[model samples]
Target: MGAVLQLLSMAGSVLGFVFLTLCIASGLYYISEIVEEHTEPTRRFLTRTIWVIEILLLLLLIFDKFPIKLTIFAMGSHMLYYQNLKKFPYISLTSITFLSSCIVVVMNHYLWFKHFNEVDIPPQFHYDPNYVPPRRATFSQVSSFFAICIWFMPFALFVSLSAGDYVLPTTVEQAKKTDEITELNSETTAKLRGRTIGLARVVIHNVRKYIYSVLALFGIQVQRDYDNLGI
Candidate 1:
């Protein structure tokens, strides 16, 4: 019986992996359309394809074999945070929001593995008509990789602010001396203002991180409750 269950679990995992592949592929196509300035229809089609695949994959988690309902809920929460990035679009907010999405995806995968370990599964089954396995899974890690890429924004902001503090003259004396040499010294004041802006950006970035961290913490708590209750 355990052997049969293991086989079934493996089958579900394979299907889940395929769903991930389709999502990534369709996402790439959507991004490509954006990059190439393609027509609205092409971009919309790609987005719709990804959404369909995502919903079907969530169904598999719920009803296919392992009862991954909690994982699906966590995924939906990620989508909320991702939408927050769209609404804000600031570099720091976008970076943190995107990283939050990545963390949520990782947690979902962890839940998938946990479900396989715990649930009783059927021996064998075939995918539905719309489900298609990828020829290679090399691109499967792209989502996580993109999450890593978002980290660069925060890092850059931090470094830029740190360097600006060292190099940008911020003293009242410095400003006064420059004023005596030239009226208002617009160039010097502009450079100082730019540095101040960089410092402000760093603060904003950290604040966004805190907001997303709170969301992620809430998600983890909900996930734990769902797992404990077997919901």
Candidate 2:
């Protein structure tokens, strides 16, 4: 029973990791599409947010006794990521940024893991008979720290960072397509109304034809009024 439970637990962990990876990939693809569609706006938003985070990290390094080296490395990595934004949608630059961002994520995870481990460990008093250590981290505290420090920024970036391959149609192309569709619809409407045919009748006639085709696939023969509709 214990072996079965252990196997089940390992399977669940593997599945969860796979699901998380898929979610991150899908989110990055979606963000890349949005970034391609709105290049300037997306770039501006990312730039501002990255700068804000850099400032916060700088403050934390200055005042809080956070690991200065890791913090500085993270800041530099973010600057590299920001530089990639200037040449938006370029494959090489984006890939570099992604690699740097991954490094930054690993650094953050390592630093925070160290911090939490230190917090969890009770301090040792040298050869003291009456030495009392502080209480260990509660479940809530550990969970909150993990969410805020370890997972938050990386998960957010996984969703926010845009890939290079995902492309949206250009604004001009979209406008042209919209105009063409509008013209085609108008022309079709004019032709139908010119024949003194009601729009509802046209829709019903098309629907009936589609229904008959489906019925025919099921070996049920239904009469199709193709000639009388003047389609």
Candidate 3:
């Protein structure tokens, strides 16, 4: 088990380095895209957020006490929030970056849980042993793992965007303003009955087709898979 753990740690370290490089390369691309360095506040915020996340991941890989549960939750939260935020101010590059981060974060969690199944990784941090799923977590492990994977990163990103941490100034007042703006927009939409109906139908059609395409490509039943995963 010790030797297996060592190998896993080494593999994780290598993967971490690769991820870091990818982050740096991507960051440069983002920075170069900025017309006015000071004007694009969200770019700065996102750069910092990505670096912080990368550092956190690296530290976890290095020390083996990276707070897997908390990190998982944070990553998921960020992903969820960012997805919703695309509706507000749609920047294609930033949106792409957010989506990419989401994919990477989810993949990391999935890989971690998948690897945990093959080898007993020493607990990186102290958690209630009772909180531990089981010696061989198997299906319960993957299910819980993905549950966090699905929701936490996106939600965290959402919080960041709402607070403006991913954009500019993430403060309470800013959040209130955002809320007001969003509410005002919603109210305006409410008044456009005919347009709203048209918009709703268009959204429904696009969403339905998109979902059907995904389903057809990946098989239609998700619930059964969750059950099979022991959810």
Best by lDDT: 2
Backbone clash count for every predicted candidate, in the order shown: 0, 0, 21
Which candidate comes out best when scored by TM-score? 2
Worst 10 residues of 3 by lDDT: 193-202
Q: Each model's C-alpha lDDT?
A: 0.44, 0.58, 0.47
RMSD of model 3, in Å?
19.6
| Residue 107 in candidate 1, Cα distance off native in Å | 1.4
Q: Tell how far residue 135 is off in model 3, in angstroms.
A: 2.3
- What is candidate 2's local distance difference test score? 0.58
In what order do the candidates fall by lDDT, top score first?
2, 3, 1
Tell me which of candidates 1 and 2 scores higher on TM-score: 2
lDDT of 2 by residue, 28-138 (tens): 545544544564675577677777778877886787656777678767766766665665434242366667766777876777666656743334666677876655567
User: Lowest lDDT 10-mer window, candidate 2?
Assistant: 192-201
- lDDT of candidate 3 at residue 153, scale 0 to 100: 40
Q: Residue 54's C-alpha lDDT in candidate 1?
A: 54
Q: What is the lDDT of residue 116 in candidate 3?
A: 61
User: By TM-score, highest first, what's the ranking?
Assistant: 2, 1, 3
